[model samples]
Target: MAATLPIIDLQELQQSSSSSGKLREACEHWGCFRLINHGVPVSLMSEMKKVVGELFDLPIPVKRRNVDVLSGSGYIALSSMNPLYEAFGLYDIGSTAAVHEFCDQLGASPHHRETILKYAEATHGVAMTVAAKMAESSGVLASDGAGLFEDWACQFRINKYHFRPETVGSAGVQIHTDSGFLTVLQEDETVGGLEVMDPSDSGYIPVDPVPGTFLMNLGDLATVWSNGKLRNVKHRVECKEAAVRISIATFMLGPPRYTVVEPPAAFVDGGRPRLYRPISYEEFRVMRQITDKQAGEALELLQGPAQPLSTKFDVNSLPADVLAQIQDID
Candidate 1:
């Protein structure tokens, strides 16, 4: 049997300021909610859909040729075991011009690029609004002054799921939390397979897809930013025999390398001055990569007290040497 995911009407949010309380409750308890009747144009969405479909339909060899996991800026194709099911991803490179040129070279409509930029801008604003409300609900900052995340960055990712129907039972993705602060996902309405673990029920609950709506969830950075006041729920995607699932997600993240992530003073109880040392985002990302490569050893390091700041990789502000290293990775 399929379970229903909660849907929160955007109209309600626009109608009353009190709606934030409800939004906060839903986010806290469910860790996921759908926003309906949002302002994104339907025509724009259609164009995006068309472009994405066209891109995916390209020859597998052409697709593979473009895959660059190290670029962290382009396309990625992998068969890995994450919390979600198996998937292929195309990450935006923060350059509208570059994406437009790439699409144009592939004979994609130029209008699609324009529409994507517009959508990204609008969605970024919406994410900021929601984040502010969440901050208020978590008591980290005032509803109007939840500016701790003003320097956040936004990333757009398009993911497609491929399931081999003959394969008896396969999981799409393993259970895991997103790496950033928050994620707003727009999933294909026809197919269903996304599921979130219900902390209260200890069972998986399905999230139904709705047209013109986005599924919003908290991520690891939010938990860290709020000092664990807000939770980043674990969720996974299962492969369905009936249809393939595709989703467009935008991740809103914290500031660049130099920014420090520390708990708010309000979250500190029992006189625990500051639980985390001030670590730059650059340092954290490198440490994260190392941790991913060596999970067992990373766990051991976590068990010990804070060691001095040893290694930090500023990918965003790479020096000439670092740029060369990245080119090698790319």
Candidate 2:
């Protein structure tokens, strides 16, 4: 048996901003919270679930052939088995070619494209709202001198976990933090495997599936953006009773790395000025992904006359048209 996770109401918090203090504390302690009565429409949620189920139910061979690790698109089947369960992963949705191929393989209608885009946009709006509130609670600015998460990028993924009834074991994801700033998850009502590690209690707490609500959790980039003010991501999924679990996650990435991330003046003291080296989000992400850890070792390298990373995104590779389209995404 696992300890019960806490549930929070976003409306209550909005009505009384002071309640955000408690929410912030919960995030710091548990690294996760469930948000009830969030603004997303129920119908949209239903359509997303229906389409995802239809897509995943396609033949196994069709799904397997679509996997592309290098291109960062398509279905990935159980490549990473968490300590307690088996799961699939997907990422990078902007690849039009891959999306078309996937839809064709599933024999899904062309309307699925509209459905996916609508879902993504709605999720993005919700993510922005939550991020703004979170930034306000954590005392961080959204780069536009606003309290909300402006200039944020959103990515959505669906996870399906299968279990065998007689196995009598856990079957889900391992304990790990997300790579983005924030994660909003809508899980199936029947299955329950999501768990968050309580830092203080040294025990695992179960986050039961709740209908009409979304679960919010911080990620590694969020911790960095908040300059350690917010909680670090620490959650895992476990399968019990051999029941399958399906979850949809929306990852809200923080402002571009070029935006400076430093502690607010209110939190900084005379002796404790800014500590982190200023780098764009893109640079940080790329460097973090690189196998060579030493590639980003020179902190003072930026202060000197050396060329900045921003210069690397050359005009030839990323034309003005491309940059304009990327800007329009937010």
Candidate 3:
């Protein structure tokens, strides 16, 4: 049976002990949830959304000026896959320099940059807190610094779904799970079309909007980081009516090449084997691009013990060609 999108309170998660169980359950089962009082200021969210709508309303030529440091990290326009959808992306939102570059590329004014930077800073704080709580919920101790992703590569994307009268009942964006560890999204409050897959893959359940809140979803990297324990939720957007829907998404992706991704020892044990081999985010990112399964397939292919953690072992053990290909992902 399908379930409503779980609701979590960020303040409660931090102040109460019971929140740990709730957080862990939502991650393990639903893989997605709605969060309230997550500490991203309501005023900032409003300003950010206004800026996003304005950003997408700009001339195509100006929008196209945005470039990608990593693949698909730039302005994406209407395509065959989803002609009604367009988006602008910014990579490594945590870094001051990256945010500045994104603003400059879009030719944003000083006010726009201020709003964007402030919103990014607030969202990142919420993301890190939620991520750490998830780990603690699963038995990871605070002393180990389990929930830190402050330096992780985060990508912020503003999505605009152009829903015209003729496009009602159409797929604005295809059904897919994010490739990152998790995504924090500010969904359109008055527009309701985002649907998450039912547990059995039998149908879809709409995630209606709640004001002053954001939604979070565990993704492929989260599943790998949790050793297959966490669910990688798949979702899509449909056009419910003729209305312009705008949303902002902050994706907290896996660690960079310098910090190889591996399931914590707590998630791996004799009874439950390691479901994935440790690989850099770059390697995983390239795999997803080549395979074209934005959700799960590439991560699955990197599974098994054949390729162990590159660290604490000799890299020469793997075939030279294979190693070279993985290195090229960076």
Best by lDDT: 3
Clashes of each: 10, 10, 0
Model 1 agreement with the true structure over 45-98: per-residue lDDT tens digits: 666666676667777656554433222334444444322332223343344554
In the order shown, the candidates' Cα RMSDs to the true structure are 5.4, 7.3, 5.3
Better of 1 and 2 by TM-score: 1
Listed in order, each prediction's TM-score against the native is: 0.77, 0.72, 0.88
Q: Which 10-residue window of candidate 2 scores lowest in summed lDDT?
A: 321-330
The local lDDT score (0 to 100) that residue 238 gets in candidate 1 is 70
By lDDT, the better pick of 2 and 3 is 3
Off by over 4 Å in 2: 1-4, 60-73, 79-107, 141-144, 165-171, 257-267, 271-276, 279-330
- Model 3: per-residue lDDT, tens digit, 130-225? 888888898766665544576787878888888999999888767777777888989887987888987755478988888789999888888888
Better of 1 and 3 by lDDT: 3
TM-score of 2: 0.72
lDDT of 2 by residue, 7-84 (tens): 777777778888778777766666677887777888888888887786677688766655433212345565433223
Better of 2 and 3 by TM-score: 3
